[model samples]
Target: MKVIPTACTAALLAGTAMSSVAQGVYDDALRLDPNSYETLTVTVDGEPMAVRRYEAVYVGNPVAMSATQPARSMGPGGSPASADGQELADLLTYQKMAIYVPEASIEDQSTAMIFAVNNAGWFASELRTSVETGGEYVSTSDTDKVGAALGAGYVFVDVGTRGRGIVAADGTAAGKAPAAIVDAKAAIRFLRLNDDVLPGSAERIVITGTSGGGGLSTAVAASGNASDYFPYLAEIGAAGIDADGASSLNDDVFATIAYCPITSLGYADMAYEWLYQAQRDEQLTGVSLEASQTLRSQYPSYLESLGLVLDDGTPLTADNMTDLLMQIVTQEIQDHIDEGGSVPALGEMFEFTSRGQTVEVENTWLSVVDGQIVPFEIQDFLTFVTQTSALKSVPAFDRTANSGNEGVDGENTLFGPAAQEYSNFTPFGWNMNEVAGDGSGADDTGLKWNEFVETKEGQAIAAQVKLTDPQAFLQGNADSAPYWYIRHGMIDRDTSFAVELALYRAVAGTDGVKDVNFTLPWMTPHSGNYDVQEAYGWLASVLSDAE
Candidate 1:
């Protein structure tokens, strides 16, 4: 066991006193017996928990290339650097992780592990703090849904990640584009590196998360072992080994379970407008009808550009988007009714009488066939969904100005790092004049935009959006997980249904993507991991096939 003092110093200084003590004990044990496995008591949220600790293992920090080492920098192009030729300071965010194995001997256990993440709204500072405390430690209570796994002998590991809204005490933008994804990959590498000492089969790791965390899970699965993220991984000192004269141990997972994932960032706004355009005439707060119309007009071209097709090979176009949505929504309702759940009464068909003009809306997709609404229509479903108001303003995601404050929304903040307050994420939101076309700035929210593409910050912002999106991997430019379980709520207006649909098509349509189980749960909201038993069964099936 070779202990690197510098890496250890970095971890010890960044971590708490209790962590230092635990690392010290683990280091001593490693020195005495290289293959020893030990448990340490660590405090999480002021609660004491017992677990195996592997603290402060350096992966490898990114350094400038010299004549002696020409290949020091790895993964993707456009590696960020300081003018002084020094690498970004390591150890600031390079922390340790704890592992928990079920009650079993280390050598006799081959339990599968869950790499659970806690990220919502793309901000991960809270999660990162939790990891430093004790690696997102889980207890028996966490297995309420998936207790079958633990009861049947499985392991659970929580991962802490850096996200879009983190500013270091020194004001450095530590959590930015590629930062969260890079940390995720590093954590996976750490697990694989210590697979021998850990009780789980390293090859059977399943990634899980909800919302933004779900987006990350999908991204990790889609971009597995791709060299595009290597530079960021190396920057954070991720674990790797030399194999066949090349760096090996890339972060790849066996399967992914993403619930209500907010992905396809580039096309979310268009999808939102296209889906909810029918409600444009209705009075709603924080919504701009003109802005909705403008974005709605642009959706057709974008939808056509994706080249996505249905399972039967029909091109998914704006012309048939309504029908496509109805098909999925109907299935969701039918599934619920089949499970013996009663459908709410919103009337089989209704007439919205507004301003002395009555408009008849037929429940085209759903009807009261045999006195039972087994399937529901899009209009009635949306009426129930938007009963109060629209979830977001026109051009929901990339708001020009922050509706809450003088700044921008979280999605906008996600594009630019924590250093800069916020910037525009999409080109549609780039030129307010173009999106609105009519020269009306009524929908513009006063958000900042990088008008000049030649600027360094502008270029970096564009690159970050491209890198964070999961669609690139689904397109087959990178590796993807063999099995996937993706679910989104039918009424989740946090992101457009188009985003999830596009992702499903990309994964299912692509060659070599073995299995994809996609569903839009009836009447569900922005949530994840609620169906633990079903997920456990899916995990069992995948593992069974592997066996």
Candidate 2:
């Protein structure tokens, strides 16, 4: 039998439990107290909307219990408590979650709960603290995005998650790769545990986020209820895990909404190189030509390995990758033209000229053959690409220590382990180190990719990368959400266009995925919620169909 934790555990999970329960006893009471909320006002569409705000609610006991406490007992999921407790207090701070229920429609809740995954560039974030210290419950921009949901009576939940660059008081990395996603899944389980008292249907959860948050959103959507994450969830004492790492309550979501997600980090570096290798300027980009070409060479096999398919069932290959990308770009241009937006003149579009010779308006970026805009020369398109967006350094992510911007690359920090501050998580990074001898301590002679994977350390990093692999999930390796809404801007430049396209294809090609509404907003940057009405409309349609 499970023990219902004392007020101390209740206080933390429900609101503010500070008193100790029993030694060695897990805080298994993960449900929220419905009465422990105060009505607060949030601005939705410039109107003051009343909402019942439940703040700083811990989803589950992430730390292990002390031996002096009560004897350990099984929780709902029945997994044994075993995670380290050294950073328990601090970890709880990042585990807290907030829920906002519209006061007017609490009795008439929407069909689903919307989990607004916070984006701090995948770095350590404190959502509950931000609200406690007088900041808005959610950002104004976020409010704008979710206003439709709030107005429609959906519960808006913002769950705190740990990320890279956070260290515990014990000098251990508190938030690292997979930690944020783990916290996210735990919060979902917590909501499922308390589904009876929650304002909306916990079974139908929709996750929405942008950029790094978008990446995590994809991770959460893809890896739903997969056994791969069970161990991590069990370590955190999340409410729903059994002896066999099975949970009665599932972590699967109904849908996902991601915008400009910098995802698939394992392939991002290679994709970046493959997309922009021709446009890279060695002196301007500060990356060696050899390093760039070496990384570029590895992309073909990686691209083919995904086995991505076009909507018409054509296999996506490196040879035709440019064709698909061009199709997406030309379609976006044609869409803007149809919307009465004028394409920039050749002079304004191209950033550079060939020896002071201005390019012609016709047959440049686009042509008016028979008075209809058609995609012209690939060179013109490539030129516009170089002109519009700046290229990232060679091997965009997982930069090695000697890769000019060492100690500062976010992706390096992301893939690094707790004790280590930075690491090369990608084969491109590793191979580049070997080729350029950039002082990453790689074998100077040569480091074979297959040999690296055979090592224990390589196996560990591969596991970490697998945790964030959407392709693995979408390709029938795990349960993925049926509905997906993804948006990538035309000029984002954060990652290769191939990244988003690959994700789109993965979802669109999957058997069970009901719908995928993907768009490339013209001239948009790496951002989200630009088309809130359309996004919400899509959400409403899907929810309605689900009913």
Candidate 3:
């Protein structure tokens, strides 16, 4: 069994002893009354696991409209699969976050916290999933994300995922998807449904996370299908789903915070290098560029041919990719740097060589794995060049294959793709920039492409092949309920603060979220060790703004 603060352990034993044995009937008795936090233990496949206590705290007073916490996304599929509207057999891969309101205490009258909890480098089965027993669910271990939420003065719910609990055997985010995001959305809907449960949940809500989770927060802020995930949700729910998982495209969330977020899916190339270099300055430090690039060349299917496919070529230096580059293009705005420092400048930042034609695009960090080469927005050549990827020096991970991913291994991905895919696992795709009219006895690129990607029931569509390498998703309300918060601190360590700041700018700029951007004094080094004072200050300001 798992141990608590010792103070709570004795009480549990006594409670168990008092159970009633009425006429050969077993009466419910033993109950472990959790303190503000505690650690729970259980075994899966004979291995012992522990879960820490997390809570939705009330920062006491003036209301913490800006209450926030960290969330996460980790495990196998470091550089996860890529997908989007285009029919280029894009493998479906994504990392994201969720937000929810937990019952708050009397002192909890405050702005909803957009809590973020990073997924450890996979293997967060305990917090991410619960074993349902009739009407109740048994909690699992792996609660660092939950603990971070509690430390932030807000209720913490699991980001909910058990990514292929594999570390890049050598960096990749490929494999089966984690259903954790689905569980999280359920938590959010539950907190909002049936007032009797967690009735004190705040009306205002937000999301926060890093790495894959960071990417999640960004999508959550988009204001779309996220609300539909829980259609019956009174306040806390996702919108709906389109081709992509849950849509956060048009929701009304109060705020979102993403750190070193994995933003796009269609603009990927030499991926790991692009990510690490982008945040090296703000990050405590990162893997050497040489290491990142080395891993980049490994683990990907060698593209037979890939010259930029269109005029809207993606920026590869920032090194991020996504399925909806077109949608992101519409949303891309220049970064607002107080002082023009090393902040990457678009247009002049990235370049892709194809058929001797060096095509460039704003290093807006958009890319996708196209055949052999990581394709950008702009179509360059037909046969894209490609290669495998690998890790330079395997650094010490915060998460081991077993217990520490939640602690740190997961966050490592936040810095860049894992060293797994370095073994060369290439996925394929095609460009529809031009191929005649719709295929009704026609060969329109769009028509043929769409037809190619259509799947039959449970099979991979013609335009795609499941890497089956292991990846994950919240994938829009696969079910009716879920519980989630942003994920932060790649399974390795804390980073991604820049994107979180950007999320504030996006929300505050458009909606009247009254954003607050402040850092915890000793928040890094490890992802935990939250400073309540800082959170209190920020939350207080948000409340004032809302009022």
Candidate 4:
């Protein structure tokens, strides 16, 4: 076995302590060894395989590690964090990666790599725990993709990232918008820098993540080597930079597999109300109802402004959106039944009965006809969503100081820069209190459109918002991923069905996109990795076609 120096410094090799200044200078350059890996046994689709695991490898230059606040300020349930931030930062593993390679594929540099973006929720205080233990080293969840990749002689890389709400001891927000995606990009670049030494093909990388991580995956797929992120990358001394200070290695991937991505934050509230406005009428009263209607009214103009078209060149308008959504719902149900999967019973709104090789949906979005499920009514689908799921408030993503939603939402914190805890990204949400006296206090507490355009802080937030959105980069100069695999559960109320649909339309309509495998699975919740076989099967076909 070839042993490589863990650090380039000679003093470290001689077992001598170095000065802090020298340590900082040496830490600026990160080096990895091709042979420095541990072998582990893992089960992939019921088959045991020998896999090489590399744990907690830093993706960035940790020159000032002791000065970093690695843990988030807020805890799991909104409590104040008690973790040792210095110790976590000193580990130099916050913006890091854990790589896994199949032993059989160790010598194959052409092996496709899966960059799994670790889910860093609104506030990722739990990431410290993940790093302290070995949780981030090997993911127990998404075994289907990771296991399938290793089983197929492919490499899997777990990319850890910074999430919102991490604060410096000086009261500066360390984790904010673009930080998470930037870290993921740096990790990918690190792999590319060592393409010759690593077991995977950097050019054939595929990214996968769920929810917030899914949003990051989408951003990485869209942004690629876009110039918007160069500053952030340089700040961390990310790998793959040439002497001229330009990015020599690309961060773009071959494909993306995102599940229930909670994205398009700037316009998510409007989309949410547009889908569930009718259902909300029964649930909300007074100020909330007015605010809901106000947001709902904002959706059609925004939808039409997008210039999105169907597969057949017809404009996707509010007049025809329900029919299109119903078509998707029917198709999902039919596909599920065809695959011998039964939808769970939903009281009187939906009831399914299966006999031998046929299934029926009674008084729901679909019904069995000649041993096949067919579209019944759009109202039935809406009713299913209404009865099954509880509706969020008027302004969802950017919470207003309304009756129940008094504090800031996660995305609000995400869009804000250092020390700016909460911000309103949308004008409609910010104008609610002023327009309808809804008592949201958004005008007072949230940043309004005028300020967003006029103030420097707001302008910075605007740029960050664009950086986090995939639509801003979908057709930009940077190369978008050629193959796209996106799935959003039809029953998911986390954001809006419209958000994912917009993303699907954008990616599918792009000229460079080779193939788009998009779906809205029936009865699936706000989740991911639901169909590992199907996802991996699609990936296998794409990889084969690439060859």
Candidate 5:
């Protein structure tokens, strides 16, 4: 016989002891104490699975702005009215989250929490679906990170968020531009709301992820309770709002550890071209020299617009951009060499005539220090980078068929809804005219193009782009997390190296941000959260500082 805890017992177990009793009385008890949960034993594929279900705990009151309209209806499907003529509000859409506390007592262990979000390629609807179905709450001992965090007494929160490409059951675009970010903030708020009942220091939460997930993590750290997201948050019925029109919970996080974040969306295309155009080898596949050059030319002005300066307060201009990047790359390589790691030979196959004889040179960029190649030249390393082929066509992020032969890129899909597969997120990708009388352009389809910038839809898309970019938050426009740990791979071509550099400069250059550690791991590629030991160390330091 399975022993189930009553709602009263569960509530008491939160602060005291856990005692098991009869299971049949749970339903009546749960209705009285909605915040209570119960654990059940079930058989799945002949294996006994102990599952804890925490259901329908209202984060905040759901009410309509006016009596005429139905109470704030938002969720997977269109807010449909019930048969009895009452609006059924689905709090599960953006208001719900699951906490997986370890078996060990949390008070005896560390008080840190990990809010892990699963997202890739700037699309996240699938992850949200998994959370709603209780899929992500599986055994946490599978991975080293999860196991280690659990062993160290950290609570794991599986956050359900809405992102681009998530079409509702009613065929409406429920998850779009600001939905993902808004949902993330709401999840953080949920943790803060249950701080006393939950088993961790809500203030010491560490948000971590890779790629687009990493980007969102950075965004969450950078924009904490920024008023810009309030409208969207209200639209989805996010938790923590009081009847007096005040927020009862905070959405701010203690620290952020992002890896290979595909961020700075609006300017990523130009930055990619500026860094890789010189390396364009036509023989390689997808190499568009004309398109690359056109996009590369726009980077200088865009860099100037950011008004970004180096640590020494030097303006970041297009003229000095290449040199600056080279300096960073060189330093990373030198650091590797200093740590007793081998520096890879450059210009290995390049033959040069020395005294009327052809000689194959290796380590051409390196300088000898005490019989060892310790120092390297920036220009030579740059020459090596330039010889490589470009990753994408011109206007990589928001690729337009009219601009180049390439199809719609991932970012274009991210900007549009499921109904529209691709749309231009930036003005640079917008074509003035279309094919013949139709706005098809060279792509032979009107769907790939964007509406006029002055149009309502166009304005909305532009706003979303700004709202999603992390740079907007770092510019003092929003509240930022004090501690940050950022890492990107050296050879990752998914986005430009300059994009990550810009992020670093923003954090390092900013006044209030603290304990910023930005690094480019040698030969690491388009990934994150590698080096778990170092991350744990950073977490320790952050926790100490918080105390």
Candidate 6:
């Protein structure tokens, strides 16, 4: 295959790698067979910058298969392949492709495309990555399954963005949002270039994903308002025209299905907040609301309440608590922090119970409830935390956070991407004010995003809100075919089909959608894990029906 440089650089800034790819000056690729393969060189500018390896797949099979053995999906080179069933294989695999290197330190617009596949796979449908879960890859991208589906008289293909890693330019990328538009355009282009992908039928497209990937599927399927949400991605790197010689997001996607998808980054904070409490006590899901209020109410107080005690039990008052909180929080968190320009420091503390001196500390601002402890100047505490965190807090945090926040800002607003003017870059949710909202500690993002989709107001502002009520939410926009698919895991004892319940309530609503389709099985993790047979089965079914 070949290396295609895309408009979006995979890497962020110099010191900050948008992804794990180490910046290098050399960028080289190799082409073999119809599908071109590029070798990412490890050097740049006549000198070697650190070169890193990334995993990518390419399929030579036809597009349309819905069922295939997973292990057999890998191509000769271990490039990304497919395992879709055979019926759909003979449809979309064709020559000629357009690829963009979404991001990198090397170059922008270094893009290519050789032979392409309107392929599908039965993998979790998406590859995911996380230090905790390892970099997850989309199993569904496997073309074998797409080819197999072709034999079944169906055609399929996947569109994705951010070629290899992620770029942190925007504030909402936990690795999902930024890549959304790019991937969608790529897939649409793949369809246009191929003879099999119905040139006039963009709405026939079927979108699917699992877990976080599922959320991606839903976002891409975006139905009618595709460009409205991410207008930035309206046109791909090197786009081509369709039968009418006109471009269309309609040829883009017809339907979308995500298995355990997290469609809105705005909701991440709420989800994580609830998740944190749930970890401590399953019944404490309500605590997320409490935490939101707690952080909000206490933030300003901390800003105005910075101080230090003169080695005794007394205290010294200061106006800017930001210094103290920033100092102490950084000290408390160490190496596990997300890199940023100037993160504020407030509502933080350094535990100094070591020296034989004890100090009484009480404040409505911070969470330091321990009566008498150690004594250290608030400013000293901040410096110690931010500077020495890599050494001190890393170990301490790793141990304490066994059940607390990862300090990595998994989804909590406190650590989500920073926002700016071009903020509307992403749709289906928040703005800079919402993401990096008024030092409220964390932005109250995606507030009621899921339900907005079904409302007329939601559709009008589809580019702004992240909502879901496909039927009523879509107002008269939905087809009368009460179609719906419910996926539940018998293995997920987590509230016994919580996803199904949420999906059903969130979509079906009191109005109840017509022609609804639902499926539940003894598979899938408790919302986060879908790495089993159940996941593959769910994807195959969803894609098949959508096709």
Q: Taking the tens digit of each residue's C-alpha lDDT, what string does model 4 give over 130-243?
A: 112122222223435555666678788866566675554456665677777778788787777678878879998899887887888898898888756655665666775432
Q: What is the alpha-carbon lDDT of model 4 when measured against the actual structure? A: 0.67
Query: What are the TM-scores, per candidate, against the unseen true structure?
Result: 0.74, 0.81, 0.37, 0.82, 0.73, 0.38
User: Which is the winner by TM-score between candidate 2 and candidate 5?
Assistant: 2
lDDT of 5 by residue, 360-473 (tens): 435456553543545555545544443332365566677755454454455665664434545666655655212243232323334333445466556666767887788887
lDDT of 3 by residue, 165-250 (tens): 33222223322221233333333333332122331343445555554555544544442223222222111122221112222222
Question: Which residue pairs collide in model 5, if any?
Answer: 279-386, 435-441
Q: Write the per-residue lDDT of candidate 2 for residues 464-545, one digit (tens) a residue.
A: 7888778778878446898999999776777888888889998887777899998787766566777777787788899999
lDDT value for model 5: 0.59
After best superposition, candidate 4 residue 101: deviation in angstroms? Answer: 1.1
User: What are the lDDT figures for the candidates, one per model?
Assistant: 0.60, 0.67, 0.29, 0.67, 0.59, 0.29
Error of model 2, residue 101, in angstroms: 0.4
Candidate 5 residue 481 C-alpha distance from true site, Å: 0.6
Report the C-alpha lDDT of model 6 over 216-254, residue by residue, as the tens digit. Answer: 443443333322222223222223322112233232343
Which candidate gets the maximum lDDT versus the true structure? 2
Q: What TM-score would you give candidate 3 relative to the actual structure? A: 0.37
Task: Rank all candidate structures by their TM-score, best first, as comma-separated numbers.
Answer: 4, 2, 1, 5, 6, 3
In model 5, where is the ten-residue run with the lowest total lDDT? 61-70
Model 2: how far residue 365 lies from native, Å: 2.3
Candidate 2 lowest-lDDT run of ten: 70-79
Q: Please, what are the lDDT tens digits per residue for candidate 1 over residues 187-208?
A: 7877766676667877878888
